[model samples]
Target: MALRETDPPEVGGYRIEDRLGSGGMGVVYLARSASGRRLALKVVHAQYADDDEFRTRFRREVAAARQVSGAFTAPVVDADADAPRPWMATLYIPGEDLGTHVRRHGPLPLPKVRELAAGLAEALRDIHRAGMVHRDLKPANVMLAEDGPRVIDFGISRATEFAAQEVLTQTGRVMGTPPYMSPEQFSSPQDVGPAADVFSLGSVVAYAATGHGPFDSPSPYETAVRVVDGDAELDDVPPELLPFIRLCLEKHPKSRPTPDELLLLLRDGHVPEPRPLPTPAAEETRPVRRPKRRRRLWLATALGAALLTAVTATTVAVTGGDETAPGDLPTGWQAWHKSSKDPSVDKEPVGPSNPFNRCAATGRSLVCAGDDVMATRFALADGRNTWARPIDETADDLGASTGGTIIAAHSGRVYVYGADDRPIGHDGMSLTRYTVQALEAESGKVIWKTVTGDGPAASEPGTDSIAIPAGVVATYGDESQYYALLGADDGKVRWKRPLPDPDEQPCMLRGAAGHAYLICTLYTGSDITGTSVTQLAPTTGRPSWTVKAKGGDLDLVGQTDGRLVLVGWTGNHRTVTLINAKSHVLTTVRLSPAQPEEASVHLVDRTLYFILEGGSVRAVDPSTGRQLWKTDSTVERSSRPTASGTRLYLASPSGRLAAIDLRTGKVVATSPGRDDGTLLDTPSYVNAPPVLVGDALYVAYGRRSVYTVDVRDL
Candidate 1:
């Protein structure tokens, strides 16, 4: 986030300040330390800065990240790996990981999963007595600190006196996270040792006590053939920690246990005791199919316009003149830029090219997609792309946005989020499905598709859609639990019901003053315990007022004046509540020093941006919470700003481009990105936001370009 206008505002001397995440070996940031601590750093990605085997695996991750310094780790506060892009830092660790606290609070409490299996078996017995071999201990490398479980990534840690190990196991690399690896890390990665970090700490303590992954499958080559055939699902685990996690998932590596005997069987209790069992009675208990859209993959790749920020869920008009008569362009408009890959008219790429696209616009079309990009159709004036459909390519192993997203054009149709995968009756299995189409926004043809979900969310086939003026709105059964709507131009469902989702934990549908709502979040396991919201009924899903609320985190953020705002924090100040979408009466407003709880708020035009996670922003004043001015949107992990009156736009998923001057928060222009290597290929998936269309903006780049720029050229 934030720092990327080609980063380096300080790297080896540490000053960067934002972006703690990027991957495929590079980008980390959130720097500091010239006596102001908070470090993290990382670097190494200027096209692998002239790789010599990625600078020898970043010089063996800065020499095994400086011998793993202890106290539950976040050590190595400085490194270089012969500079020029290679760097390191560390010591930042402030908690939130353990797979994002077991996916926003769910598992962990079998005494915190046996105290996270005795603080990750004493941080793998101090990185196996400092000689390394962490070989990636999952749950996103642990973290969870209130003075406890730390671990962290020594990038493919390997230092039993580090010999080459084939430049650290790199042939078509599968280095870690196949449900916490270990079957000698997929059948002997240079004979992985220290018992593969005690069998990835018995699959990260059975994914912190069952929030999944104990040879979990639905792909990863079937969890590496059930983690090399040791196949331990350990049914809801807790039969007193299932015989020391079935002797640390033993499938040889000298049949498991040593991180000093898994910390002496977790500090002398010898482990197995509190055995209970026999429950399953309420009609033989049911609930476990799982895949509850996994937060719809962060609401279809980064708040797909905050799940339609409200009002007929945007029938185009974030300033795009409700259809070309007075300003929002379109009558043979100018400022051109194209290439949604035109290799003599499309179809050459069938792989890698997904430079994370994503789009949505109407009154002058737009389209776009990602993950091996396809649903292409760009023409908000001179960028002429035209039609594109083809690429279901067996849904290319469903890894986020597989050729689908047009996601809403409305009246003259468009919609998208496709994917099909053919044969539902062959012995060779194939059920990807996904649909929601519509099309014909000036002839791409097909006017109705429908279906909605299928395995691996098919790659966000429009996850939790929404529009509704009697048209879009989605969700379908199999834990999406129903609710339909459809008919914008005849796919015809016209309202179905069910989907209130009693305690479904990670809920969220959103929309707002042209109504939809939903929200949910109550979770009794691992505590969140209250936050319902409801609202629905646009043509009969029928709740129209529910609320529930207890303690903090309410969130909706739009409807305003006709009521239903939301935002909330409550203790050290930041409320703004509101409600009354017809006398529901709430009110609040507080707001002081509490913005960044992973920011993102938004609102626009009635003020209250917030944003943060590095592209900065802030503003506030949701009617008297005041604050109002903070800048920097130099586009790094951006997308989702788009305003229009006094500018705002935004982009980056390596397409770069920012704008921002909504009243002097000045970054008025910035662009440069995608000098090829899409910054380690996924500079944050499916970004695609700056598509404005009237005073021309468009924005999307590399791996098949789009470009437009000219909010009066900033």
Candidate 2:
């Protein structure tokens, strides 16, 4: 489509070439950046610029689209949310939308439909992983690229965190295409989640297969009723796909299969290969074909019942594998597991719902701390329990607590925070006195104990307060208002000093070979005002150098190549700042547009790796501010990645481990995830980063279990 004479020549510096399309909210144009990168720039209609509600919706659409990046989703490149006429630009994909393609070339073939299903499932998985639900997933929003289908348009998407506030939709107003909207969207818009997308996927696939929606009606009002109450018109849908589609369209959200489940089913070859369409002459004389005998009877049973059994049976088979062949195990290593919970003492299963099991690896031993248990050592070779000790003091019971035990093991010594069990203050909130206990790594016997100070009143489940490096234990005392450094061998305080500010709080404390660094955030009321980074002298607790940062939230990731690497986010943009510890010089590199705001940053050597919420990994050079590579790992909500040479490893909450090649940012191998049958309302928290020592990769899956894998085989 050619551009109109009245259209602007450029938008936010992008040179507009031709008209792509126009929707209710804006006009999409094909444009190119100054760097010669092509983009689909969407400029708001002139009338919407003055409408506050339209501007807010446009801003949210930009944010929601930026949160998702996957193989089958268009990536947002740049945007000006505050512009006079708000606009967003995404990667220019050269393909027609699914609706246009079907209207021009009739319904898609079975093979094409199967491919569409797989691609759309992956896209939805990425969207849901980033805490969003694409409420308006219809055929028109899916572009049929050469590689696969790409889900686009987040205009009506809602972030799960802020779902309570229906910022875009008014009360009692339907917000999606009537034919594709889920029943929940019509009945209760505020309660939609990832399941809502699944229901819409069923309708889209049905329309592609038969060139008409499953619940097609002359009027949208009747279509809404059919979506909530009428039976789907799937008689024309392929038999191999009917059952899966039926499962997706289940009335209950819980009854519908997850995107991952759908992907697995699609990849298992259960759906037969699509046959080529018959010629017109052959069709005129050819007899009609019948459904395959094996699948014919299976379709007789209600799809909902059969799908439930199939899903349950598959889950059990996958999770029940407790043994593996010796040949399959890593070289010079055997698979091993040890229970964090003692059956004789505790009743509930050791998982996210109960207490969290925190573990660290040093040398040949693995140390773990949990509720009631101060510290326990296990041999890495065979997963045998070396020693265990019980602590008498109980943790504060505000929520599902993890017993606030901070443990670090190094140099044949385990450092832990032991509770004193004494109440303080007028409120009777436990004074939460903590004593740092140094235990022998081999015997679990306390070598020495030193009183630290009162701990936090309510310990958050995943917070760790101490760090041990090079035989030095570093702890922060809230009541004493000081930083303390104690000798690991003698348990004597080497030095103690008050924090820089009376109201400042420690955000991160990391220790390396000979130096320890502390980062403190200064809060003014409920908001953070600034951050302070101090490199402390090994034994004196004195600052060797201090860097103060304001105007953004700053975090010290770690030191790389004699430079301290820090990440900061001001508003919509993020930057990586590298400070030279010796020269005190700083170099700042602005990240690419649309980078994840809450990405987990890890510094490995000279390269910085960012793991986004949707499991996409981006490697950048801090010194030059150039992105080395970016790739999707396909694991949702994974842990902070650990690097071994050129390979980076990460583990998901589901216990799946992925190894990626850092040079190319590609996943080279992945192990089957362990399923503990633990279901939660939210994603499970990662207790610790993947521990890589020699040939073994130790991963803790929340409080439930710890897994040891031999990466040499991978």
Candidate 3:
């Protein structure tokens, strides 16, 4: 690629030539030093240069790269962290990245695969000997030099010393490409040793031999899931190499072969002659199957969008096949769906190109609200729209202007908070009058409306603004210190109270076990402090119990058997905290060191499950705080998981559905995701979690439509 005008002409006394590539953190350029030595200069992005944490991380990467001394690895030449844009230079091998090579030349032969493995093993041995772990070792980070291969990119690498754990965790960054990451990287990143690099090397070797990763998926999240719960796609791989690669791809890091062991096996010539394996049946490899009705509907929609009907199915599946068992899908129902992009609704402009649609289920009816659309109900049996109403023009304009939406439909009532910006008094200042309106869920008729005094602007634009449960409707800003529980029937304030500490802000509010609990976190400027969990009486706004958490951010999973189960994170390590509301006895169990800041935790019965950003799901026992099982679902940006019976359901933003067995943590069934042909710069709206009512599951598709699935068929 040619160097762009914005790129620096020179960096760190190196003469810039052309661009090598760009990554999440910075851009790499092909440059030459003053002495005429070719170099790869990596200049940190301007935006990241201003971040103190990123700067420190960049410094560590430079330091780690300098420590490594190996023939099959790129060596650091020079670096200047104090420069205007921190930059590092390394010996630029004259070759292409492994990914590019594979994409252009197809899969490599067995001999080439063997050679690549040996080179990577030697490189890893050198890196491990230097007391460093190359946390990220994807294909794109490996260079196919003329002699062999050179491992590069230490941006997320860490020193093996004890102090490195603290330094790396302090940044709270979950680093690595999902498809190439080890299971431990997703479940316990900070504790990852040299074995993680071996796992990545196996993935790279698989890609080299098959032109595809062992756990390839449409998104990184889904790929991560496969890395954890699914099997390697080794049917196309050489039969003799399958066993060697499988050992490297084991879920348990300790079970994987060390670099030294791999070298020994390669040197011993224990690998057999390459032999072709029988092609697996399509049914065996393809897990997600679309019903005939879904196929026809999708074809029609794709034709409307002038796109070919290309459906990509998931290759991973649970050990158990999708069967009509006692606890599977409900009876007397078949899977049915309706696209929100129907001709009637597609023509209506919803202000934001991609707006997030929120949905709630009552009985068999699903009510959804978003953007220009107020609230619409659909029959869960057939996905038929019962009623559709346009939001009030006054509220619509305000929501569009501020990029906010009114959340509605809960407990048989639709609630909307609208703003009436009317100027009052001589000063000509517009008084932002916030109105709380309640509408009939079935008919969409305005039942009652009340004016709530000027409240803080909604903390989150879409999903986190309102919570309606049982007899009360609660509203709070994402970071507001004040919260109010309104009567569900009349839209009147039942009880409003300030959080325990005025300086502390509430991050989440939920109603569980007939009680409303507020989780607040203390913030000193931009840094976070200890979190406070308080149980409040909905009727009287009285506190029942309050637990002050440690320094990490806290997420309230839910109450299990009268115990509050929460996941807390400090640095990169996550811990499960169980608090007994009555006894006020708090037990904090430190989990393996992993990045849990961006994970969503849910409590079903006595088990708490964590869905991480990288698409790994782990089930933990709150009583013992022991992780029962961890599986990868490869569904990126997935909705919060919902459980029923012994099955757990999860949905991604792209409309992919995955069902896991609660007892085994294996994916039992999956649905081919719906990919509407709309390409927007940003997601239209936040994804709503799958709502499981009886034998049916309801999912909000992007910000456009809602669909129902009969669990029995799954």
Candidate 4:
């Protein structure tokens, strides 16, 4: 494959020459050192760079591969597992992997299978002598070099003396490819020894000759079941090689021939007379979790299994200065829930299109806004609604609701929309003109208020105005759309410019990382013609760059590591687009296995978290376009997650709050729904993502209620 435009030019003095491939962990590149020695470099993805657990695994892999040295195994050449994007380089073996070779051509001939079998056995001997067991041995992991087949990718390997693998074995968390795994590996991983490699070698040899494994099945779970049940499918194997392969796949680990013994059997060109096939394990020997675990029985990398076991959430602040131990919350912080209401005491949710309440933290308290309430400050230490400010009583009708939404809060100032008095228009009718205001945080007094675009109302959150790192950008006007960048302190317009209107329709303005973007869509009747995101310069209202896509359904959710993340729905799947803010390089991803119709997505720390309406959550790596894990929970119809450390904070429409473990995709803890059990204040708005500050999580729910939940309590 060619190197992608987004691929790094070099890593740790190694110049990237070509693209090799990519896996769940990272991308592999064909690189060369200063001496021009060719090597294959594996660079970890940016998303996993900050992941402490993943870095530990990368270090272990580097150490394990460094210990083993043989012609049959790819030797570690150079490595720096501590680099920003951790990488390890190994000898560049010249041929394609056995799996790809077989896919391009047919199954290997008898002579080549013998060569493959002999080489792999020798590789196993070298690995075992180094006190390591290659847990994952499959055709894809075996390279058919000119000299022999070389075993590679020791990422999941373990030392015979390693007790860490033993601890994981006690739990139901199983790893390794199902069809290629040994029977003993599935039944008792803690008891796995060097013989497990011999069994996998047999499976790899069988696949080389027959283009399939002896325990192949449509689904990985079914394949795992077959392997555990000792159901071998060997009809396609050559008669001469059947006995040799059979001897290696003995159900009992003790019965399986060791790598040393396998080398003796293949010493000659032909095998001796076949011994009787070993008896299969009885049904009683199968693990007890098999039958009851049918829904998601197989524990493997594919189809979203948990990446790591859930650990207790940590509350270490990202801010510099003070630090705390794991699970320690900020001083005086307590989990509390409260609610308020619109002046009319509305019985149901005020807005059917967008959520009513939203919040942002400033200094020692949280400033919030909703459909009915203009602005309210909640104590950060508790859930007290310190002060509430309802929408001004204007004679003219306000757009969306009487209350304005909070655009942002910073430097002890809260930015929100306010309604100017109703005045008769030129058409002899009372008209409402919205005003954008900057209010002091201590008191509900406007510092400055300006008339917003006298155009159609923005019913959705972030459609009309959004806060950038510099200040707030408010969109106004109809047909000819215009946006102005207001100074954060003075509320004075820093710059004003017209936004493109493809079909004479207004474009939505959004902000991310101090950058302003104009989301434009052109439609013909009910069908969308085109969609594009044109980023505007923060200092000046000038177009920096614009990227166009097919249709307008996609939304600009967030940005991470200088890449913008846009999400859209297609059929039952969601398409995620990652674009480099500077390079303009685009990478599109289609979430596999499809998602529920009501599924929502959020991006944080370069990872995409998707939540289904029924509460199934999926964590996907946006860089690699792979789903890390999927977990089932009951935190239904929750808002987009506010990520901190290894936990995700979210709230449901009914004010139910859930703290999810980011590493394991498990629900750590959840607070009960509102005592009043009302959804009027918290409408189900996709744009109203949750907010996390320090060790406290502030969420708006129920009838005008804002709650503060401490991670330590969860």
RMSD of each: 24.4, 24.5, 22.7, 19.9
Give each model's clash number. Answer: 1, 0, 13, 3
What lDDT would each prediction earn against the true structure? 0.61, 0.63, 0.62, 0.64
Candidate 4 per-residue C-alpha lDDT over 532-580 given as tens digits, one digit per residue, 9 for 90 to 100: 8898766667887988876567778767767888877555545677788
Candidates ranked by TM-score:
4, 2, 3, 1
TM-scores for candidates 1 onward, in order: 0.29, 0.48, 0.47, 0.51
Worst 10 residues of 1 by lDDT: 287-296
Between candidates 1 and 4, name the one with more favorable TM-score.
Answer: 4
lDDT, candidate 3, at 616 = 91
* Top candidate, metric TM-score: 4
Per-residue alpha-carbon lDDT of candidate 2 for residues 535-605, written as tens digits (9 for 90 to 100): 77654667788887664377676666667778864443367777777787777778764357677667665
Could you give candidate 1's per-residue lDDT for residues 44-95 as a string of tens digits?
5566566566667667756665776667777886787677767777788887
lDDT of 4: 0.64
Backbone clashes in model 2, listed as residue pairs = none
- Judging by lDDT, tell me the better candidate of 3 and 4: 4
Q: Which prediction has more favorable TM-score, 2 or 4?
A: 4
User: How high is the lDDT of residue 553 in model 4?
Assistant: 72
Error of 1 at 152 (Å): 10
What is residue 326's positional error in candidate 3, in angstroms?
10
| Stronger candidate by lDDT (1 vs 4) | 4
lDDT of 1 at 700: 70
User: What's model 2's TM-score?
Assistant: 0.48
